[model samples]
Target: MSEEKSPFVVSASWLEDRLDDQNIRIVDAAWYLPAHNRNGRAEYEAGHIRGAVFFDQDEIADKTTGLPHSVPSPEAFAAAVGALGIAETDTIVVYDGPGLFSAPRVWWLFRIMGARKVFVLDGGLDGWKHEGRALVTVQTTPQPATFTPTYNGDAVTSFDAMRAIVDNGSVQIADARGPGRFLGTEAEPRPGMRSGHMPGALNLPAGSFASDGRLKTLAELKTLITEAGIDLDRPIVTSCGSGVTAATITLALHSLGHTDNTLYDGSWSEWGSRSDTPVTTEPTPKKDR
Candidate 1:
């Protein structure tokens, strides 16, 4: 197994060392399911990492799309992030309340928007607090910076592109939803959507990629992907309930040096609702397991 470190993930300790750097920007990208009944912005206002800005998933999304949390256009994203004092050259570290959950989405967003040196903070705020790291309740507001975004279209998958991939099987589609949802045994969290995965998509829950909030080792990650019957060499597109956890797969793939990957921003919300799109309810057959 390869032992390469992903440019997309950084440990809490590593970030702690650079806390005083003026050019380094940290963002708290915490978001929760409606069922969780937690407000991300309110929690951030209560307390967060010192000098960290809050990235609202809903605010920085494609507002025109009815799908939940779709990726915003490069122009919109650049403006939103720029308003938060982030520039193209800043070393960004993003974290969430639930360790590895929402942070990857922000990490993937930065990369897609052509920001270099972007990383997800391992273990998120939970990990930092677990280690007794200092947090501040007083918000720190910085002057907005000029951010120039150069969109990398290849890092994102459009609904039409997904339809083509589904029909042709040219790319591997991986769903990060739970087994029940993936198998259509449970109802989708969102109303009016059917449960089940995209045709030919493999079910690999995003939680499997992390333990105690930190990402698994590269060897373990490779095993997880291979065991799921995914061919690392093939192009891969990851999807999940909305588009948040799907980024966890993208982060894992990036860690393993698989750059030929994209995040389906519409994810299940788009695929499961469209009657013309193919859906699968059958369990993935095990090979004599």
Candidate 2:
């Protein structure tokens, strides 16, 4: 088999070469769950890839929505990112504290918001630091730039659209939550939420796509999805505990050359909480070792 072309991922070495390039914009898109109790901003302030401007997920998100970290409107997103000096034509490299976790969400956000040159830093800051790359502790303020957003509606799945998918089975729903959570054997990290996978959804945890903070090879990603019985050719809507890690699956699918995918923004936070939505605890057997 030939080497697969990566879609949303860029190497640390590639970014290192462009660190001084004027048009290359780097963003520290770090975010953590409330349960983790870790302050993403503090971490980013302490150390981050040189020249990276912090992208606060909470501050940049839809404040009107009650759901956690909901995707902001096209106008809202453009304004927030534009304030960080990112332009539509600039090549964006987003990374987070954890390897592949929160970075992909921002990557997905940029893509949906019509940024053409957005890419996630493979392995994130952890990999960058481990590789002895220079990092900066002092914050750098960037002059705000004007950014225009053209929303790509097809890339996102709204709650109503997900409901239709659940009922009609027109789209494959893949949950990136852990197996225990998917099986309802574990409590949700977020309190007051029900635990169980969406009915007919497949469990493929986000961690399956990374190791040691770096994304696996394309062949490995393809094998992982195929073993999970995910049809790469079919349209898939990836979900997770919230909307965060689901983007990891989206990244993986994109890396495998599967572009026909959408991310369920509300994910289990919306699906599992509703009394009317279908839920299942059926454990799927592991496909391959």
Candidate 3:
């Protein structure tokens, strides 16, 4: 028998062939910025992969934190996924609309919560549709499945931890926001937030890791990180606007067997808004690039 692919990702046809596997559970983690005027839940209702449950990123977040998409309490995460009938043992497949966008956040969340078998849909929903695969408007209501979560606290970072990391230079900071946003050349999409980036952080825009709605191969991802001067062996703390796309970096790191990476759950929204945290507008030096 052929060796099974990495549980971290699977192709469209691979998932299609196993769509009916009773142990398989699919999640639609599609989300868009308000600027696009697109609603995730509404779009999912319009049409999505068959047997896919909608994992509402914005809705499932911890509202107590002022930061957008803050990591929820372990109890809250367990409750949320349990309500979705997602058992801890289920083989989960997560996907987003344009592909490598928001789905990696949900995928990272699952791994941090100790799900043994989870994967992101290669090429995402757009790729599946482009291949003329079937989509359904009908809702898939799964029976509630108990999900026992053991949160990996080390796999995530808080604002305080990020500050300390910056001060101590213990972990490599990988900012996943675009270069424009990283260099203060572009206005922040969110109001009331300062433009630019955290001190001592390097830009690694999440969009660069994929093309045409699919992530690049493993070799490409490794080269991307190395070319940016990031030493893959060092511990990394991934960050981006809010905290969603940061997970993309975490996912990429995980796919390469690097386990010392963590997501800064508050990301730029928290760092830029704080009066105490120092934000820099000077573009990164060419030597660092």
Comparing 1 with 2 on TM-score, the higher-scoring candidate is 1
lDDT of 1 by residue, 173-248 (tens): 8899999999999999998899988878898899999889988888989999889978888889999999899999
lDDT of each: 0.88, 0.86, 0.86
Relative to the unseen true structure, what is the C-alpha lDDT of residue 243 in candidate 2, on a scale of 0 to 100?
A: 96
- Candidate 3 collision pairs: none
How well does model 3 score by local distance difference test?
0.86
User: By TM-score, highest first, what's the ranking?
Assistant: 1, 3, 2
TM-score of each: 0.95, 0.94, 0.95
lDDT of 2 by residue, 1-289 (tens): 2465366788899999999999999999989877667778999888888889999987888877688889998888889889899988789999987678899999999888888899988888888888999988989788898888989988889989998987787888888988889999999988777888876788999988888878887888888898887888789999998899999999888877788999999898888878888887986444311
Give lDDT tens digits, candidate 3, residues 1-289. 1232234888999899998999999999988877668778887898998899999887788998877877888888989999998988999999988889999999989888879799999899889989999999999998898999988998889889999988887888899999988989998889888889987788889999887877777788888888887888889899999889998888888878899888899998999887888889776553443
Candidate 1 lDDT for residue 57: 93
Model 1 spans > 4 angstroms off: 1-5, 286-289
